[model samples]
Every structure is written in C-alpha cells, then in structure tokens.
Target chain A: MIADLLTTVLVLAGLAFFAAGTLGLLRFPDVYTRLHALTKADNLGLGLVVLGLMLQAEGPAMIFKLALIWVLVLAAGATAAHMVAQRTWTHGEFERRE
Target chain B: MNLLLVAAAGFLLLTILFGLIRVLRGPGSGDRMLTAQLFGTSGVGILLLLGFALDQPALVDVALVFALLAVVAAVAFVRQHGLPEPAGTPMHENPVEEQPHDPPHNPPEDTHDR
Candidate 1:
C-alpha cells in the first residue's frame, strides 16, 4: 500500500515537471533559453518517473534497466543541449517567421 | 495502481501535444528540434507507465530504443545543417583571436571532398 502511494506521488510530481518543461519550451523567448527549459526539466522529470517505476519493478534486473534508461537519457540530453547551444551561439539565432 | 499509471501516461501524452505547439510556432530549427527532444523524453515516460499498467515488459525495451534515438536525431541535425560560419566571417567579434591556432579552414574543403 505504501509503495503504491509513493508511486502515485512520485509519478504525479514527474508529470508536473513535464508540464512545466513543455510550457517553457513553448513560451521561452529564444532557442538557448528554450533549450535550458526543455533539457533540464524533461530529464529531471524522466528521472523522477523512472524512480517511481523502480519501486514497482518485479526484480533487480528490472530495477537496473530502469536506472540504465535514466542514465542514458541524462547523458544524451546533456550532449544534445550542448550541441544545440553551441550551434546557436556560433551561427546566431534564426528569426521567427510569422 | 493500474488506473493511476494509465492516467499518468495519458497526462504525458497531453504534454507531448503541448510540445507540438512549440514545433509549429518555434522561430528556428533548433526550437523545433527541442520539441522533438521533448517528445522523445515524454514518449519514454508514457511507454514505461503503460508497460506497467498493462503488464507488458516489452515496452521497456522500446523505451530504451527511444532514448538512444533521440540523441542520434539531435546529432544528425547539428551535422546536417546550421554549422558554424568559417573562422573569419563577420559573425564572430574576434574569430581569429578566439581561434588563433585553429586548424586550417576545412569545412568547405571537406564538403568538396565529399
């Protein structure tokens, strides 16, 4: 019962973060800031969701796989964020088209 | 518990839908790509939730693949377009000073060679 309760709270928290991230992505003024919003919030949200899921996993192997997915996402998200920021920094921001 | 998981997954799908608005209104390619990244992460969350809610372990493997592909898509975007300008271009305030020992101008040459 406790496990289920914790999962509910954690997963709901994760969903909140995902909503904030998407809001930031849509509302931010520029690419760099949007990158900041999307990458950090989304990955953290995924981590929390993964943590919640881990509690319900059937075995150690399943738990390990969940952890692995979170780590992979962290690495990939960081790298992609850096590359996008670098590209924007060097090439200049592209103008918004109406 | 299962209903909670399924609801969470549905909520995540809603977030993805919101992200698509950014893709449509985004000022630049980077912004659109960011939406794609958002989709990738959110998709993983949805799959995991559904897998547990529906009792299908195979969806976890699909989540694993989604995580891998997101980065690959970003890398490909960076490589295929919007590369930095040549060192001496007016884009940078002090390109030469910033990169004094930079390697020979090679992007164009490399493209030609390709």
Candidate 2:
C-alpha cells in the first residue's frame, strides 16, 4: 500500500516536469533556452518516473534494470543537448536570431 | 495504482503532443532537434510507466534501446550539421594556428606559396 502511494506521487511529479519542459519548448525565445528546458526537466522527470516504477518492480534485477534505463536516458539527454547546442553555436544559428 | 500510472502516462503523452507543435513551427533546426530529444526522453518515461501499469517488464528493455538510439541520433545530427568555426574565432589559441598577422587558415600553405 505504501509502495503504491509513493509510486503515485513520484509519477505525478514526473508528469508535471514533463509538462513544464514542453511548455518551455513552446514558450522559450530561442533554441538554447529550449534546450535548457528539454534537457533539465526531461532528465529529472524521467528519473523520477523510473524511481517510481522501481518501487513497484519485482526482484532486485528489475530494479537494477529500471535504474540502468534511467541512467542511460540521463546520459543521452545531456549528450544530445550538448552536441546540438554546439552545432547551433558553431553554425551561428543563435546569432541569426539576434 | 494502475489508474495513477496510466494517468501519468497519459499526461506525458499530452506533453509530447504539445512538444510536437514546437517541432512543427520551430524557426531553427536546433529547436526541432531538441524538441525531438524531448520526445525521446518523455517517450521513455511513458513507456516505463506503462510497463509497470500493465505489469510488463520487457518494456523497460525497449526504453533502454530507445535511449541508446536517441544518443546515436544526436551523434548523427552533430556530424551532419557541423560547421567550420569562423576564421577569427579559433577554438584554441595555438601560435601556429592563430597567427593574427599571417594569412587566414584557409588555402593550404602550398597552394598559397605556388
């Protein structure tokens, strides 16, 4: 019962962050700021969701697997954001906005 | 518990729907690419939530694969869209490379010498 309650709260929080990230994507003025939104919020959001799922997961193996997926996502999100931002900066796309 | 998980997943789907608008209307490729990243991450979150909600653990593996693929996508984007830094704005200040008095880095020394 406690596990169910915890999962509910974590999942909802994760969803809220996802919503905020999407909102930032729509409302931010530039690509860099949007990257900020997507990377930061989505990373945390996914982390929380994964944690919530872990609570309900059966066996240590399943918990480990969930954690692994979240870590992979966190790394990928940071890497993708950096590479995309670097490309944009190098190409002067942001400058074009100004 | 199932209801909560499903509701959370549904909410994430809504965010993805909203993010699609940015992807469609973005003024720049960077914007689109990052928005796609948002999709990838959020998709993983939704999948994991649904996996638990539906009592299927294999979906977690699917999410792992998705995350790996997203990294590869970013790598490909970087490679395809890489731009040469402006002549004056060298990333490093090597004396051989950043000689302000010398000719710019373009045109090989041999080509210029000839």
Candidate 3:
C-alpha cells in the first residue's frame, strides 16, 4: 500500500516537472535559456519517474535496468545540452520574429 | 495504481503536444531541435508508465532504446546544420587564446637561403 502511494506521488511530481519544462521551452526568450529549462527539468522529471517505477519493479534486475536508463539519459542530456549551448554561443542567437 | 500510471502517461502526452507548438513556430532550428529533445524525454516517460501499467516488461526495453536514440538525433542535428557565425567575430574564444606563449617557445622559423 505504501509503495503504491509513493509511486503515485512521485509520478505525479514528475509529470508536473515535465509540464514546466515544456512550458519553458515554448515561452523562453532564446535557445540558451530554453536549453537550460529543458535539459535540467526534463532529466530530473525522468529521474523521479524512474525512481517511482523502481519501487514497483519485479526484481533486482528490473530495478537495475530502470536505474541504468535514468543514468544513460542524464549523461546524454548533459552532453547534448552542452553541444547545443556551444553551437548557439558561437553562432549567436537566432533572431526573434515579431 | 494502474489507472494512475495510465493517467500520468496521458498527461505526459499532453505536454508533448504543447511542445509541438514551439517546433512549428520556431524562429531558429535550434528551437525546433529542442522540441525534439522534449519529445524524446517525454516519450521515455510514457513508455515506462505504459510498461508497468499494462504489465508488459518488453516496453521497458523500448524505452531504453528511445533514450539512446534521442542523443543520436541531437548529434545529427549539430553535425548537419552549420549556421553562419556573425560577421567580423573571432571564430572561437578558446582558452588557448588567454595564454600568451613566449616567442622562443613558438615554432622556429626556417633559415635556408634561396
């Protein structure tokens, strides 16, 4: 019962973060700031979701797999964020359309 | 629990839908690419929720693949699109530029007479 409750709470929180991240992406002024919002919020959201799922995993192996997925995403998201930021820094901000 | 998971997944889907507006109205390609990243992360969340809610472990593997592929897509975007840097700007502000090397340490000039 406790496990299920925890899962519900964690998953809901994760979804909230996802919503915020998307909102930032759509509304933020520029690419660099949007990258800040998207990369950080989304990854943390995914991590929370993974943690919630881990509680309900079938076995040790399943738990490990979920953890692995989260770790891979964390690493990949960081690298991709850096690359995008560097590209934007060098190339300059894209002109905004009125 | 199952219903909750399913509902959460649906919510994530909604977020992804909202992200699409950014893609369509992108003032820059980078903005579009960021939406793709949003899709990838949200897609993983949905797959995982569905995997547990529906009792299909195989869906977890699919989520794993989704995570991997998102990075690949980002890499491809960076490689394929080479936006022109602003005019008259230095190519890069590398750290090497911060240090001034002694003239003696520089490569020796060729001294052979013609």
Candidate 4:
C-alpha cells in the first residue's frame, strides 16, 4: 500500500515538473531561457519518474537497467542542450530581446 | 494494480506531446536539438513504464538502446559545434586582462642595409 501511494505521489510530482518545463518552453522570452527550462526540468522530471517506477518494479536487473537509462538520458540531454545553445548563438538565431 | 503505471505512462506520453511543440516552434536549430533531447528521454520513460506495467522484461533492453542512441545524437551535435558557454561565464577570467602588456622578450630587430 505504501509503495503504491509513494509511486502515485512521485508520478504526480514528475508530471508537474514536466508540465512546468513545457510551459516554460512556450512562455520564456528567449532561446537561452527556454533551453534552461527544457534541459533542467525535463531531465530531472524524467529522472524522478524513472526512480518512482524503479521503486515499484521488481528484479534488481530491471531497476539497474532503468537507472542506467536515466543516467544516459541526463548526460545526453545536457550535452545536447549545450550544443544546441552553442549552435543557435553561433548561427545568430537569438536576437537580443529588450 | 496496473492503473498507477498506466496513469504514469499517460503523463509521460503527454510530456512527449509538449516536447513536440517546443521542437516545432523553436526559434533556432539549438532549440530544436534540445527539444529533440526531451523527446528522447520521454520515450525511454514510456518504454520502461510499459514494461513494468505489463510485467515484460524485454522492454528494459530497448530502453537501454534508446539511451545509447540519445547519447550519440548529443555527441554528434557537440562534435559538429561545441556547446555554447552559459552567459556571464568567463571561460577564463584572464588575470592577463588586468596586467600591463609585456615588452618583447627578444631584442628589437635592426633594419640594416645589406
């Protein structure tokens, strides 16, 4: 029962952050700010959801696999964010907003 | 029993949809790349959630492979063009900027007529 309750709460929390991230992507004024939102929140929100699922899933291998996936996602997502931000700036895509 | 996982799965799928919006309207290529990153992550979560809910072990490896692909995409972006340094971050707050210009170490060359 406790595991189920915990999973429920965590899932909701993860979803909240995920929503907040997308909202920021839409509402933020600039590319930098939008990257900030999407990179951090999306990575972290997905991490949390994976963790919650790990808590519920049986088998040590399964949990380990999910954990590995999260780590990979985090590394790749952050790197991609950096690259995109770099490319955008280099390409003069961001017009300085007042 | 399965309802919670299914609900979580739904939320993750919704997250994917939001990610699509970011990609579609991104102001630049960088934004598009990063938005693609989010989709990569969301996809892994979906696979895992489905695997767990269905008690299937096969999906875990698929998620792992997805993880590998995502990393490759990120590295490719970086290789083609290095990531942008964050604003206000001085890569090297050159103390040299504060120091006076140094004179040439070697003697000045003489212009002698041959």
Error of 3 at B7 (Å): 0.4
iRMS values for every prediction: 1.3, 1.7, 1.3, 2.8
Ranking according to TM-score, highest score first: 1, 2, 3, 4
lDDT of 2 by residue, A5-51 (tens): 89888878877788888898888888888888987665788888888
Tens-place lDDT per residue, model 3, B1-114, is 999999999999999888899999987888888788878889999999999999999999999998877789888877657644333335335454346665454222212121
Ranking by DockQ: 2, 1, 3, 4
Which pairs clash (backbone N, Cα, C closer than 3 Å) in model 2?
A: none
lDDT for each residue of candidate 4 in B37-78, tens digit (9 for 90 to 100)? 777777787887788889887988998899878867766776
Best by DockQ: 2
Q: Write the per-residue lDDT of candidate 1 for residues A16-97, one digit (tens) a residue.
A: 8888898888777888778888876557799889999999999999998899888888888888889888888777665443
Fraction of native A-B contacts kept, per candidate: 0.74, 0.89, 0.67, 0.65
- Model 2 docking grade: medium
Candidate 4, A20-87: lDDT as tens digits: 88777767877788878877564778777887887787889778888888888777777777766777
Write down the C-alpha DockQ for each prediction.
0.67, 0.68, 0.63, 0.47
**Candidate 1 chain B weakest lDDT stretch, 10 residues:** B105-114
Q: Model 2: runs farther than 4 Å from truth?
A: A95-98, B85-114
Question: Alpha carbon lDDT of residue A76, candidate 3?
Answer: 74
Model 1 per-residue lDDT tens digits across residues B29-107: 8888878988889999999999999999999999988887779999999876778444444544544545656557634
Worst 10 residues of 3 chain B by lDDT: B105-114
